[model samples]
Target: MSALLELRNVSRSFGGIHAIRNVSLTLQPGQIVGLIGPNGAGKSTLVNIITGVHPATSGTIVHKGERIDRLKPFQISARGIARTFQVVQPFPSMTVIQNVMAGAMFAANIRSMDEARSVAMEHLTFTGLAAMADRPAEQLTLANRKRLELAKSLAMNPHILMLDEVNAGLNTSEVEQALDLIRAIAARGISIVIIEHLLKVVTGLCSRIIVLHHGELIADDPAADVIKDPRVIEAYLGSKFAQRQMVRHG
Candidate 1:
């Protein structure tokens, strides 16, 4: 599979402090990648840079053989890259469908308002939000709120979908539901880069896992192997958890 997105030697900084350091990664079509790291590991910073919410200090972002490092967020969206925030963003006053329709407004495929709405409705259904279609966006429970956020991103007709901790704070069953949504998306041939803290969600849903620490990538491999890396264990996965993981492996 060819790379749909590539970040080469990407680096980001805030004032004088470095947030991301010479990071390079490739995402291929239909691949589900897990990015796991401790807080301040530059996971969000990398997402922001890729999605155009934050400009890179220095690097090249290549998408479909074109440079896109400098595009605005909406411009990036127009280029077929859609990302969901770690914190869900829903228009509180709008209905669930309306919230998704807002994202469809940027879609290049749907030509008219009616077309956008139709597509948005389909995406809400895909994410299991059809029953709550008329509910106020803010009225949904936390799990559904995350599902709404995923639906909104899906409505954008993305070639590459970036999710930022979409499973964080969810109960086990809710996380399973969220994982199912992600699997459905991947099955439709969308490349996904998921930044998550839940190891189970990552190991279960992603084909590969990438580990980050101190703003640099330390491991990128199959999900099972990455979890077993000693560096990943010491730096991010604690000793006790690693012990339990080993026991399960054996």
Candidate 2:
């Protein structure tokens, strides 16, 4: 099957420094893939390029077989690609539901406020923010705010949802809850690209994984095998991690 999203030889540079270089990736329909690396690894930069937050310095980004590299952010979003930020940025003045309603408004079919509200409520309920839907976005706890972020993105009716550090600040139970929610989302046939620092989360949630280091693509394989890759260990997961793994298995 054709890839839902494709990045070909994609690179982005700031001044003389390359933040991403010669990176190519593909996301298949209904697949949940992990994009992982340490800080400064250009994961966000690649997401920005895909979402059109910034233009690529050199290469092509295709979504649903159409070229979107030159498109505007909203244009790309309109075409069914949505993303949640690493830093939650809810509309402080809006109620939790209202913040989600704003995202629902992006759907071309959601013409009336009533329709948007209904759509928003479904996403809010799905994300477990239904109980707090009436509260101001700023009043939510870190975990709730993150749920709100997911709800808002879900409101967009995206085909490919890219989540940037969705589990960043959650407690263990909350992380498990988020994992279940993400699995539900993927079960509904939406392709997901998760950018996470938590290797366990990636290992648990993703079937395929992509690893980046020093702004370059270093590995892409099944989650189990990728973690054992020497290049990945050298670049991010150090030797001590492997030693612990060996001890556990042996």
Candidate 3:
């Protein structure tokens, strides 16, 4: 079967700097994949390229068997690809539910205000934000705001969802809750690409893991093996960290 999203030799550069160099990967339906690397590894750059926030400097991007490299950001999103930023920026003036409604309104379908609101409520409930739906978005705590971001993206009804550090700044319990939410999303048939620094979290939730080093993909394999790869340890996670992981999981 064809991949839901495929990047073939995709690269993005700024002036003389190559943020991503010929990185290729595929995301299959309902699969949860992790993108892991140290800072400056071009993880966010790759996500930006896929979401059409930045065009690829070279090579191709195929979504559901259709080439999408040249498409605009909104166009790519309309095709059922949605992403959340590292920073959650909810509309401060809007109520929590209204913020989600905005995403539904922006989609090709869900035209009426009532329809948007209904869709918004469904997502809010899914993300555990139903009770707080009336609160001002700005008033939400960091963890709740992250949930809001997830809810808004879900309202867009994406087939492939790319989350950039969705677990960042979340507490231990919140992180566990977020993991459960992500699992539920995948259970519903959404393919997910999670860019995360937390190795334990990635290993726990992602079936496959892709590691990038200085803009190049160094390893792409099952999460279990990828974590133990020597190159991955030397480049991103230190050898000691890898040793600890081995001892714990062995």
Candidate 4:
């Protein structure tokens, strides 16, 4: 099967500073891929590039055989690419259901308010936020806010979902719940790219892992192999520790 999304030698620079350099990867259908890196490793920048928040300075992004490197963010969303921010930015005054309805109406192109509401309700229920649908978005707890973000993304009817730090602030049990929800999403055949800092979360939830460091792609492999890679180790723990491991092993 063709890839759901492909990035070819993609690079993005802000003036003289490179945020991402020569990174290329693919997201296959129904796969959950983990993107892990140290702070300032360009993980978020890479997501932004894919979502068109920041367009790539070079290289091409193809989704389902169409080049999308030049498309506007809304255009990208209309094509079934959706993403949630690291920071949840819901419309605070809107009801939870209304916030999701916006996504349905705008990105999914639902023309009627009633139709959007119906679609949004399905996603809210799927994300476990149906009980809170009538509440103002600002009234939610952090975990619920995250769920709201997920529901809104689902309302867009996405083919590919890139979740940036979706598990960031949750406690252990809450994270587990989020993982289950994510798995259910993948079961529907949506390709998922998760940007996470938690090694355990990444390893347990994703079949494949991609590592980035200092604006470059360093490792892309299965979870088991990626965790053992010296470059991935150095990216997380510094060169001295990586050297010590190599010496101790050999």
lDDT of 1 at 188: 97
Query: Residue by residue across 111-214, what tens digits does model 2's lDDT show?
Result: 89999999999999898889998999999999999999989888989988999999998999999998999999999999999999999999999999999998
lDDT of 3 by residue, 70-178 (tens): 9999899899999999999999999999999999888647889999989999999999999999999999999999999999999998989999999999989999999
> Every model's Cα RMSD, please?
1.7, 1.3, 1.6, 1.9
lDDT of 4: 0.94
| Shift in Å, residue 102, candidate 1 | 1.1
Q: Estimate each model's TM-score.
A: 0.95, 0.96, 0.96, 0.95
Evaluate all candidate structures by whole-model CA lDDT and list the values in order.
0.90, 0.92, 0.93, 0.94
Model 3 RMSD in Å is 1.6
Error of 2 at 23 (Å): 0.5
TM-score of 2: 0.96
| Clash list (residue pairs), candidate 3 | none
Model 4 misplacement above 4 A: 237-250
lDDT per residue (tens digit) for residues 184-230 in model 4: 99999998999998889989999999999999999999998997797
Deviation in Å, model 3, residue 139 alpha carbon? 0.5
Please identify which of the two predictions, 1 or 2, would achieve the higher lDDT against the true structure: 2
lDDT of 1: 0.90
